[model samples]
Target chain A: MNAGQQTTRRLVSRTGPSICRSCLDTLSRQPYSTAAAAAIQTEPQEALPITPPTPSPSYALHAGILVSRPPLLTRPPHPFESAYHLYQKRLNERLALPFTRYFYIKKNTPGDLEWKRKIKQRLTPARDIGRYRGYGDEAWNDEVLVGAQESEMAWQVERLLEDAERDGGEEEGKKGEGVQTVGGPKKLEREPVERPMPRVTEADEKGDVRSLGRLLQRSLYLVVKNKEGEWVFPQDRLIGKESLHNAAERVLVQSGGYNMNTWVVGNVPVGHYQHDFVPEHLAKSANPTELGLKTFFMKVRIMAGQADLKSNKLGLTDFKWLAKEEVQKTVDEKYWRSIKNMLAER
Target chain B: MALRELPSRAASAVLHNSRPAVLALRPSGRRNASSEALRDVESSSSFEVPFVSDSLVKAFDPIERSKRRRLGKKPLPPSRYQFRPPKYYRGPLHPHQPPPSSDPVSREFIPGPFASPRLEQTYQSTIASDLMTLTYHHLPPGYRAPVQLQRLREWTGDSPYFKGRPLRPPRGGGGLRLLDPPRNFKNIPEITKVVVHSMVPEAQDNSAHLHVAGMIVQAITNVRAVTHKARHNVVGWGLREGKYVSVTADVEREDTFHFLSKLIDVVLPRIKEWKGVAGTTGDSSGNITFGLTPDVVAMFPEIEVNYDSYPPKMIPGCHITIQTTATNDRDARFLLQSVGLPFYGKLVD
Candidate 1:
């Protein structure tokens, strides 16, 4: 019967394996099981499909947040990519049009003299654009721009400025200065100082999991260690009748504290992870009706602040803002496989 | 930032260029040279710009010199070897074939739409991936989609005309529905170009209204507005046949980005009570159109900066058409919504 069950399981596994297979059978049967099924399945498989399949095992729905900080800095290209680009640059340079210096620059003016004085007359045959110089015959050994992974936090600043401009417009309009006064939108022109934050933070150096400062060049997802000593995204069981998105909002606050400002990307769940409850754990809890857990992941972007695990009522043991690879390493193989697709590659 | 990245994308085309021109790849290229050189000497280190003083710029007049050069000289004759593309496309077998578009001198060669905008960047980085995941249909490995009936139906009951007739289109009126291909990573909806069109009815009576409209449109869009002739008389809108009724600027390439960013960032916010673009804006096909009133048009920074230059009443309202690669309105709406343009009222997706 056990071997028969395994074979039958393999047969109907495509419908919905494990706990939900029975309910899936009822759904599929109503729609009429395909001719393809009859072509593939044997007589023995058909007998077990009918009986003891309508019990309708209930699974608790969970709303989980994969709160992530998008890559703060664009990643530097690999050595090969940079080299290919360098080659392309040199190729473009070699097959280029002649520069009409006579037209653009006058013969003996200060600007013209400065152009002659400042221009580095290299032995290379090609007239170059910008500073990727190919000195002499070794022009093939060109070095392309290696965009350093530095955090200017320009996006954050731009967002703040945009928000300010938007919010301030109404007040300015009320003052009769916005549209009326030629003062024109109050320009906040700050001379951009090179106050770049170090790409590698102190948290990174100390290997501190609690800090969000580490990993500037990759998407850092929030993974919390629950009471079960398992690393998972911030998750909790859904309360009665709340929508999936709202449940996600409530779940995050319930598990983690209210210190962080988060923007949930959309109302719908990105993906879901399902696991059959362990028989032993189910026995201990004495829950005959409960079969498994299904977590619907809501993608939330953490704009500012930190997850305060200490003050949280749900009692999460620890938390880490780790990149994709680190996330895979921290979570179980099954859990990793399910949620990995939803997370950003970098 | 876009100005710095412009040159590298000169070879690329009007498409989804999310990687942000080749300048981002190199360290030296990444340095903000133009800004440092042009703005001030103290702001930058070591590198010195040539003395670009007011006197130097004032003295170095290209227009005056060009005027001087052409003062007495007759126009130069057209070069003997200069190639003009065939007026008609001869067969491929013909000896005097037209050059491919890739050729630099080809009339069809359009070098730009370079430097994909920041909005495209936002789409590529975040919105696109989010959309793909949300719309993903996970069919467990070998699960086959059930066979479905074709939308178009065959003619029945043997009418003589029906014998050789092609399959009739779906039962709806002669409206042809766009093919909604299943969403995947590769075929993500992308913004193509923006068309800024303005109707100047007063232009028929006096040409100044048309010129002012064209100038304002050109200033805001960074693309020269082309005057469009009315095909026939429309008495209601004051349009007459052969009359210069409207001017339109097709904002493609870098201008699309610039125009969109300027519209969203500068102008849209300044509006006192913008309820947003109408929800039923998009045609069933990909393109979405929204209109900006003359009052709203006044809010554009380019016009606002030089408010005294134009007559206040002459500013013409324009319809902005956002063309996207998506085949349907829903996808186009999603793309625009993700880029922070809200759509209010009954969204008919």
Candidate 2:
């Protein structure tokens, strides 16, 4: 026999010890038996061609009692597990840390004033009254005298001039006699004046007037009034599992209707404020929980999309770009004091 | 008598002023002549009338003269003075006064009973509120919205702003397009090493048990297993320092891949009751460790075929640690998954 046939015969003898020479001879007589046909039918269509007939009598023994079968059974299907399971397991096994909330205290730009002006003009025109006043004709009129007695002295000089012109010859003769009586030669000599009087031009005669006073502008803080009518800055809670800066940006988008891609958010917090109280919505719920809410206020500059303030889902009832004084009047005293410096002009 | 002397004083002033005028009228006159004439006129004055010339006044009081000059030549009203508002006045004045409340008061101030419900409904019906409801109600609980899903919503014009900009097509005619091949495969995963470890109890410190465990690891991994001594004493468990407590084998490169494939395809399935590896088996450094029973370890063809070579003693369970070239457990798990290993839990953020 060839090496391949000899090796197969040895493996078959080792695998199926119970199969007799007569059974093997009978199987050789009919290489394709009813049992083989049944096995082929039961096997998967693609696997049938790849799998050679089993050397053991497991398939043939079921049809004829010429050989015994081994006790080993076929293996079950094993499917590959998913990666999501590992992620969840790791998450559950992780240690918990304390919750932190971050808030953004955004700065208003010069365009904010223009926005406020436009809003005021459209919604409430009365509030658009100018914040400036002209100093009036009195401030503009620059003809005030330096001293109270200077005007009277000037008038007396003018009168003296008129009298001198009327009686020139007689007055000159008297003045000459008086001059001869009191140290004549020394009195005749004159010294140069130390200072000269400034001449007045036509422009000076008209007056050195000042222009009108400038408008008194004030810095506007972005304030929002909740459904309960309490005025507060645009803020929201920071959910767990995110960096403070990222949470702050999300809060701006979710609560302030800010677009993150368009807005330039500051990496560090400008200031921080904390308070212990239950939120209005939470307080109204069946279970009220008081929380020590800490907020790290970051600064954000809006680059686009300011007109859609009404698009925020937080249910704020009113929004106003108010000055520091106005915001103080509207919000709680303690809350205002905590964030007063942040709202001040930088 | 002093009143009678006033006429002589006026005449001397006029004569002094006239000499300068005559000097000014004659352009050709030498400066020395005018200066001499001025000195003579000043010396001739006998009556000392308290009247100071403008030049003398300027010399003595320059600041006052400049102030008057800046104020212009016209005489000013006596009553003019700098205005200073009273310290107590806090309210606005003139242009600063609050604008007349021309706009109607907001209906929010009125009692809820008197307010219009229709107006309130219209106010509440915003796109953001709708989106919030959709996200909360439509999506599965704890399911993070994937980036692609969010981008899909934005591209479909569901977002109020399209990618934070107004929803407008480019001037050149192209519209928003989806990113090609949704997955980013820049971070490819690779198998780093495979470690097989078996812990033997101190009570079972017999050489036969240790030898059998080492042989099993060596046979399955085709690598030599190293026996590790216990570092600390555990009185309750009867473990002592310097005792052989464990045997471990590390397989790398081609061997790691071969061992992993063999374990997944041949050994793992043969276990009587297998439910895949635990998801929490991985460490932070992307190495995943799992345990297999002695029966499962024996199921390896290497151990199964030559069952008689080793003594038929109870074999100890062993742990298989698969390390990957990944930064974290998530990426390691993904790599393992790609290589046909199954994991069982949801990924957290």
Q: Candidate 2's residue-wise lDDT over B1-349, tens digit each?
A: 9999999999999988778666667755445632657655466544234666666654654445567786957766767664433334347654423323331122111111211122122212221122222222222233333344332222454765556664445446345442322112233334678899999873245767888888788878867699998888899877888888889999864457567778887877676656677777776666788888777887888778666566676577899898865556765676566456777665421
- Local accuracy of candidate 1 as per-residue lDDT tens digits, B1-349: 8987786566465344655677566556234643455345355533234556666655764446667888989977866896787767789899988889777456565444323355655666677887775554444444565566687888998679888788888777865677777677888888889999999989999999999999899889977689989999888887889998899999886677778878988889888888998988888888999999999999898788667678769999999999998888888988888777888999876
lDDT, candidate 2, A33-133, per-residue tens: 43355345544543433445543312111000000011111111111111222222222222112111111111374333433433333222111111111
Q: Candidate 2 DockQ category? A: incorrect
* Chain A TM-score across all models, in listed order: 0.61, 0.33
What TM-score did chain B of candidate 1 earn? 0.67
Docking level for model 1: incorrect
Candidate 2: segments with Cα more than 4 A from true spot: A1-346, B1-186, B202-204, B345-349
Residue B321 lDDT in model 1? 99
Tens digit of per-residue lDDT, candidate 1, span A23-69: 33333442334534553556555555444555456888888998988
Error of 1 at A317 (Å): 2.2
Among the numbered candidates, top DockQ falls to: 1
Position B326, candidate 2: lDDT: 58
Which candidate number maximizes TM-score? 1
